[model samples]
Target: MASPALTPTTPATRDVVLVPPAIAMVWTGAGRPHEIVAVPGVVLGAGETLVAIELATVCGSDVHTVEGHRAAPAPLVLGHEYVGRVIEVADGVRAVDGAHVQVGDRVVWSIMASCRECDRCRRGLPQKCRAVLKYGHERIQTHWELTGGFATHAHLRAGTAIVRVGESLRAEVLAPAACGGATAWAALARADEVADVDGATVLILGAGLIGLSACAMATDRGATVVVADPDPARRALAVRFGAAQVADPRDVRALTAALAATGSPEYDIVLEASGSPRAVQAALEVVGVGGVVVLVGSVFPTEPLPVDPERLVRGLITIRGVHNYAPRDLDAAVRYLRDRGAARPFEELVSARYPLAQIDQALAAASAGRAVRVGVDPRDAHRRC
Candidate 1:
């Protein structure tokens, strides 16, 4: 006879089943604190999977929602950057590599779950599908209350691109790959499509998680990278991540001098991840003729940036904006982290950690701008920081 199927009560399954009353932190609005409450166990749908969140990092976009910088559905679960272990897999589910998803597998999923038949999906931009269901941005519903990483359990819905990660990878090193790392990969991929990244002169504005990841990726590809950020700590961190030179974005002279020292006086590729309007303007100005500028930030509302039509015509510059990320980008991100994470200071990118119940402190640490990324330990949901 065939072996019996493993039950939820199995010792191995203990990793996914919380002690009792699975809890989640609910973000009510901009100025209010999160509410800790028990959430029901997930009832997986067809092609869905249930994962117990191992570690979740507070992303800048999460801070934006909490601070009212961006508009999102009220009372949502506000986290997207995380890594988890699979608890249960529904029928007909496969990973990005076309392998069947199994229980007890460590995984990271795409930020946005898209309907494959949508126009954007058909056009090769599934990240922007009309029926996209963003994990952290969705409203709470009875059927899908555990949609975000701030919770102990996330119900991975159908069409969500899941990639199985290695069991050996540290949670902190893998969490940011969901958003910051993947988006940066998407931006660089765009630049590579326009101009080869190898031996390219690249300028990355913003030394935060995305910026620092881009810096490391560019340098890994043989590019001479210059990173600009207002934070001294982040700049120092960027150097460790493989930036050939670092500068203060606020100081135009320092930026200009760095570019001149690069021997080109202009960047072949400029990646803007700071979300600063001035930085966006600066990216356009410093990019060389036939250069490509990939804007990976600026998700929030900002003042209109004035652009000169004559400059675009004369410089032959290309400007592209990358939001969330494509599935292929997420695939590349996981592989990159799995392969190069040990060589670079990728683990240093997550500077702080807090238990899920101490989410307020976690968000505080994240918003304080001192940490590249702050993590939340969902397994310690009831513990102190």
Candidate 2:
């Protein structure tokens, strides 16, 4: 004899599952393999909400975390560059209600949550917020903070600075704005002090996301932008982005001579977006007296850059190191993209998109320079759906 199905009036015996669906990439140990795991029905915390991730980009930083080079714990959820829709909001979180955020509203949030009362936050530099914690940090325990955008759902805290994207912008296009685009905005803010973009000559090193963005902004600011990169394709892209000139770093001497013929030491500002030490050295060589050199890229296993002290002193050079972006920077990037006509045709920086199940392939494509931006669609059928 079989038991009858429980009716509304009868007592239930089955466990009430509480876990929410999440697609998480987990590393077992150092040099060990990683696996994507699915958790069903994870709980959302008070003053928090669950976001159904629409698109999550694989940033260079994400590669560092996955390779265990960042000293982060294993079996972690990866990804910080993302945009999504709010599915559930905790009680008392009123701002997100009906602002088109029910089940399917376009949105994006910052990577770190800063305590607004902190000294750094008070000073208008929330990136330096002392009490802040990143998404993948080992300290957070709750599913909301632990499982980041690489999953089906991301837990957003009460203080999370969320930006609502317009319906016109494509999720795949706006995804990079969360990190790569924001970083470029921060760099430009610092560069403006010395670059005097209205009429100044500027030299930009590398043609990656940051470099291309700088070129675009500088051109918009009326500066003559010169870009250098070894890759021909990137060099061509830089030219398309409005760079006044593009050259290969290997032919620095010839490029410098040609520029000098037009007018030597023409650059009033040198922006180094390449982490290579050689590029830094070349940047210092090309900048004029009283020029500014902004270091915007990160170099791993920090080593002493071979810089000429005498030249730096004699040239009255100003060297500034730029880190991650602040909230204001993100706002600026969004505004720039919005105002510049979101439909502007540009190269498809995203070369590929892999489902969360194929994270290994995605990571490899990102790290090998095969793709400028690789994305993971966490809600794909093969993911922990």
Candidate 3:
């Protein structure tokens, strides 16, 4: 679809700086692969900022979109995990935390942009607001065109909560904070409320980046984590991330049986981060009576498992479902990476790095379980870093 006429932007009470054109990777569909597209830069509109993305990571949901597991509009710029520097800031634009922002400040923002007046927003659930503009998740036919991080330059629209980042946070470690880290933080936030997360038996159902991030976060709380993954390599990484035990998902039945034999109750808290619907039932089986299970993954739809509400009632098991995250989760994600990034080898989870054009290969590596997460640098198409 051809975009309509471009609206002229007039900077508020200041001179507007025009940016130069840059390249971006636009998703065509599942048929072939994303194509390289040249994005023309324009004058900064009021409440919009142009950023140069330093690192954008391919999320599991991005892989799901390319593989047809998740439904997304075609021909959009499809990336969200990112860290970038502000090249231009529109007038009257302020961070969500009410701090003043300027150009050249390294920053990270929430994936979901919400209207502050919505009911959900008032209740502190911005991700589910009536009108939420999620960067990278939206179809690219709208204005500015480059809403995702796969591009060399992206436009930060109004309602985006911009937080200036510190040097203590590395791109690879902070990139996933937009989605994965915030997601894990949101899920664990609920788990921490009902149960004693510190020193509790926390079972994470996937050792992917989100799971590993949850592992690290749980470690900070003194939780004894036991992670489960079908991939042996992921399970190994879980150990390094402070998981006391790692089990294969295929052996969930056996693993649960072994736990039953111990006579101690099952896990006090279960986090489903595998993105597999089947893991939901497995999670039910593993969570102890009166324990809590937070569904953090399942961004893609799959076969439905039998849900027995009576069982939940009888077991007193609290099941919470976290879709995206509250805005506070984003703040916590950046803060955790800033404060405790060096304490753990969270950077080790960054397994593969590829240039923007090689995103297909990066996605392939992540899909094949060779890497937990992959990075894409938009400026250098040929270099892998």
Candidate 4:
């Protein structure tokens, strides 16, 4: 007889008691088992706040972390893109009162926390702040400091980085803006410096969340956008989201022919979000000699790409890597969503929503590309308990 499948069960505490602790799905190591552990209540310090997580989304970077493609320590908090409510605020937090952020005020936060005294912070590049504490990096050895949104609540050190979500947006859709959407917006902002979008030709490699968002943002900026992806469903969705053209990234000959037929040998700018070495090479081939290539996706193991150094020297192609979003980038993304009513059709991108108990199922679905985005709602499981 075949073995039975293991169904995800509601997390249970010791002694069969139903205590609502922070449940986190953690990876032990490379090729090791993953489990859900219920951690005791996290304590907050002065000028800190505990946010009750409303919704958290699984991202591609999360997959990289799980598969040990990156140097992630075991038993780490996993999520970065999320929306939550302020449950408690510590003493000495005067700028934001209970009125400004009550016990139930919904908000979204940035993944990176920076010290204002850093030179990068002074220059408005908090993403590169020298005293930054990334949620997943194990180097930061502060208790209750490295926790992320994957749990029931995340601890936030007080600063001006958090953005209060307006009533018009939903948590499921707004969760991804903290990372994916913000990254795309920052890449587009940099690409705009070299290519005037009023009537320029732009190409995006990858039709995933960041790629589609790039298409929408470039269209909003008046650029004609072309998208390349292997998935037909994503390509169709890109068209609906405002892509003028779609092609397959693997078929370089076809892509070249298509571009040639359009009377342009190269696009003014190429946005690479696929993180594939081939995609990066293709972006170099597709962009004009003087065009720019903005890399927004994460590349693991620091692999080298098959690029001709001679071509790079002669092409003068401006290649830039965008790490994370600045505070101003987040504000700009919020404004774009509000002004253009861009998120009205965001429901289509949300492929599934699972209770926190089904976190394993959610991660599986995301890994299989079964959805554009998968959300975890903690309230559902909390209610059952």
Q: Which candidate is the best by lDDT?
A: 1
Kindly report which residue stretches of model 1 are placed more than 4 angstroms away from their true locations once superposed.
1-19, 382-385
Order of models, best lDDT first: 1, 3, 4, 2
**CA lDDT for candidate 2:** 0.70
Question: lDDT by residue for model 3 over 272-332, one digit each (tens)?
Answer: 9986876778898778888999988877767878888888889899988888887788888
Error of 1 at 202 (Å): 0.2
How many steric clashes does model 4 contain? 0
Residues 1-385, candidate 1, lDDT per residue (tens digit)? 1111211121222123445656789999988989986774655666678888999999998988888888988778889999999988876789999999999989999987777776788898988877778889988776567879998888787788899997878999899999999998999999999989999999999998899999988899899999999989888888899988899988777888988887765789999999999999989888889999999888888989999978888999999988888888999989988888788988877889888988888998999988889999988775531
After TM-score superposition, the amount by which residue 161's alpha carbon in candidate 1 deviates from its true location, in angstroms, is 0.9
Residue 213 in candidate 4, Cα distance off native in Å: 0.7
> Each candidate's TM vs. the true structure?
0.93, 0.85, 0.90, 0.85
lDDT per residue, candidate 4, 1-385, as tens digits? 1111101121212111125666655556656554566655644554556778888898877777776667776667777888887777664443222335556667777777766565677887878776565654432233453267666777665443677776777786688888888888899988878777666788888988888877888887788788889998888888887877788889987677656655655788889998888888888887888789898764565578777778767888788889888876776766676676353365567779888777666777888896888887877655532
Worst 10 residues of 1 by lDDT: 1-10
> Where does candidate 4 clash, by residue pair?
none
